[model samples]
Target: MSSRAFTAALACALLGLIASVAAAYVHYQLAVAPGYESFCDVNATLSCTQAYQSVYGRLLGVPVSVLGTGYFAGVLGLLLLGRRLDALASYLLVVALVGLAFVIYLAWATIFVLGTLCLLCLATYAAVVGLFFIAGAAASVPMIDLPSRLSRDLRRLSGSPAALVLCVLVIGATATSAAWFPADSTAAVQTPAERASQTAAQVDAEPPLTDDQKAQIRASFDQLPRLIVPADAPGASVVVVKFNDYMCPPCRQTFDLYKPIKAKWAQQAPGKVQFLTRDFPLEGECNASTPTGSHQASCEAAAAVRMARGAGKSDALEDWLFARQTSLTASIVKEGLQEVAGLSDFDARYPQVLALVKSDAALGASLGVSSTPTFFINGARIAGGMAPRIFDYLIEYELSKTAAPVPVQ
Candidate 1:
């Protein structure tokens, strides 16, 4: 390629990098915020809020988007500055490809775990894939004389297997440290309060219930907490409070089961049932109860939920978050929430909301609720989940007690 053409190609790559990083920022903001007025909640089923709030959103302790920002910035800088900077092209190509591998992994998670698709996120994915190819093109740039350099490196590899192994290990270690060590992605770096919450949750282990016992308890409750509330109805007679993690897979399933009941009860009793959802994101970003980062983008997703809650759209946002839970990764969940819920501006006022959500998580721990989908029916606790039929049976029993009835002979 001519010098001009090469420079042009490099410019395109740099532009893509910039776009990807910006998209990553949008994704991260939506995934971490708390609310339904997010971009992902555009539709009940096609929500980014759900995907962003998932466990798959995070990698190690950092927001995946934050990592993306750094990675793309590096690539963009390399491309823009490489012609004048020594060894810039070489480093850019190698680092971009390595980063491409990680991005590919996240893309796979988006397709497989978070089932929803974000057009912007897909565009970012395309940019990464495109950059991987651009890196290949960059390798051919004249400044580095890569072919000869690689030949020598390969020759060294051919003769010294131990040296090759050591080189690979060194490269891998460097990449990992670069990704994980920056304060941005590092573990909660835990605050004292968070540390205490983590310690308390760890120490207070609740005993597991038997299957039959679990069934009996689920059967005893009339309705599970649902995210949405009925309009033009009386306040609920039985309030079921739910402490949930957006990224928690089992919680997603349990939420699905309870959703129908919420709809049914609201239709049947019209204001006799209400569901109060509190954030319990497993990511430590804003959640004091999380000991370690398990779910990737959970903190941002939780923030989105908090934001949505503030807007009086908590149920709508929570359901939307869960509905699209499969599409978002932890990185983009917060952004999805922000876009769909239209509460991007409310992010500044959410620290207290986040704290309250975290406190609710701590309360869940205090109440001896370890796993998610923990249902409290008017102060009666039902730990774990239940079968749909069992829930139906329980609801009928509760409804009968309140319903006017004829006496049996």
Candidate 2:
């Protein structure tokens, strides 16, 4: 084959590889940014948000795409300047084989696990295959020790780089097919019921909480004077202590469910139940539970809540925090605190109050509160912010224990 044709084929492959890198960078940006809409918005079954946030998205500590982008960019650069380097063909040949393996792994994950493929990600997969073909074809041109059976056949195919071009076309076709035609919607869609069933199946796989841990959680709730309840007249057999983050959206929703329960029990059956709110922000600046920062503005929110509690405006502050959660900036939260409860001087005492909030956060972490809206009801954990229905179920379950005493025959 003419050198010009070979060069053109290599350039086409390189173009695809570059496009892949660009797509990967876009994926990274989407993952880190909060306001970005979910890919599922296009179609509920096709949401990239769920796939990107899953454990499968990361490899060790780094993002999978970050590593893929770097690797593909390196391979493309090496192939582009292959003529200058000595023993270029041998090195390129080995790297192509390694690239082939990575492409296979990515394809498997995208197909079987991720369920929905980002169209651009599929383009990157095709680019890997094209790169391997071009590199292999280029390497075979200057053969050193050709095998008797395969060498002669490869010479014809490699001589014109036709085989490599054909391979690129095949990859492009495969990627196009995969992107345009998706699997059945039913096959891909995992409804709430299915997810609940899946969770039930995995429940037995988890290790049970230890006795000492249970006792510690129980002791923490026992210390609170008036634990949080849902209804005005709670049956009063059990006390629930909740550790929550004001800036957390889910935590706010959880409180919305809990507040009514508390009111119902407080009015109907007063001395029976109590509810207390503990500050547990999931931010690295304040909470040491997590090593990395999840929420940047959580520490300030915690402090504002604390100041509200101190000024005898706990209920008002709690309402304010939940209501104006989206605008929980340092200034806004402080201003709200002052406006709602006459707690002035937020700026003058910012440093000391911030430190105290951080200390409280650390203390919550030391007591095994890793996530927001964690709860302990009479020593039993009700983890994850379930909806009002779940709250009702728990209330009934607790009341049943009182009604159905063990028979002593």
Candidate 3:
């Protein structure tokens, strides 16, 4: 390609890299700084937050945007240095084509699977398309001594092993740093006093529930199906009910936060906490309240959990499912049931299991649950993800009402 066209390609790739970095920043902000409002979160259907937090947002625990940032950076480097390495430039064109294909798949997922359009994601997609075209143009430039040019470039690169190693190490370090340190470090440096103040502020910000409101919440909890409580749970002084979907990312986060608190309570005040999980699948296949095709595998997953519960393997199955939340599907659910619990009769029991799921979903819908991971503590609603301190406060508050001091854990 001409020098002018090659420079233009490099410029486009640079622009793309900038967009990827911006998306990564937004992702970090959303995760670490709760209630962050993004410019691209125009609505439910066009929310950048939803897209970034969804299952497709990450690949094998690393955020896709972080990977994109490194990818575009590498492409930018290759475009700038391609003049002296024709073979490398040609190979990058192939990489660009592969990247374009992957972006296409992500676009399909965003539209059909996620049912949302993240403007930042779309911007990155545009960059990839532009890079593919630019790379294609560069590759199309005919070379009289293509083979000889590649051979010479390879020999030159091989001869400078130290330089080559340094470059590889630099790229590897950058990618690793991006992945490991994606969140804002400042967010993690809060002092104990600052954290306590924040927790107190959050609790104070919420208006106290009136007696009537508390009674209504208690009645609502009493009406819902009571799933198995922890074997060692204390008496029902603090009944915690959760409406959760297996496919929901926030639900997974909430569960992770709750697990430790539940464990502590089980050790300290067994039988004092009555925790019940109710199915609230987001997919319309079993949950008539939800939009069709959204969270398509959720109903099946919920049924799988019910099957596990029947087989006395609910805890193991729940842990397994939550760990693999991003990849939950009918096949995976079946495999988990078979492998984790040895439920060979899943197919035979599926209909009964589905009935249990429907019952819970119906109960959730009756309680006005329009979203997953909704929580109720001692008949008072504690919606969305919360800090562990908040849960501790609520549990203590309930215990305080009874004239008996909570046993120290």
**TM-scores of all models?**
0.42, 0.45, 0.53
Cα deviation of 1, candidate 3, in Å: 29
Report the alpha-carbon TM-score of model 1 versus the true structure.
Answer: 0.42
lDDT of each: 0.55, 0.55, 0.70
Choose 1 or 2, whichever is better by TM-score.
2
What tens digits encode model 3's per-residue C-alpha lDDT throughout 247-348?
A: 765676556556767887778777777778888887777877776436767888888888888779987787677666545678888998999888877778
Ranking by TM-score: 3, 2, 1
Q: How accurate is candidate 2 locally (lDDT)?
A: 0.55
Q: What does the lDDT come to for candidate 3?
A: 0.70
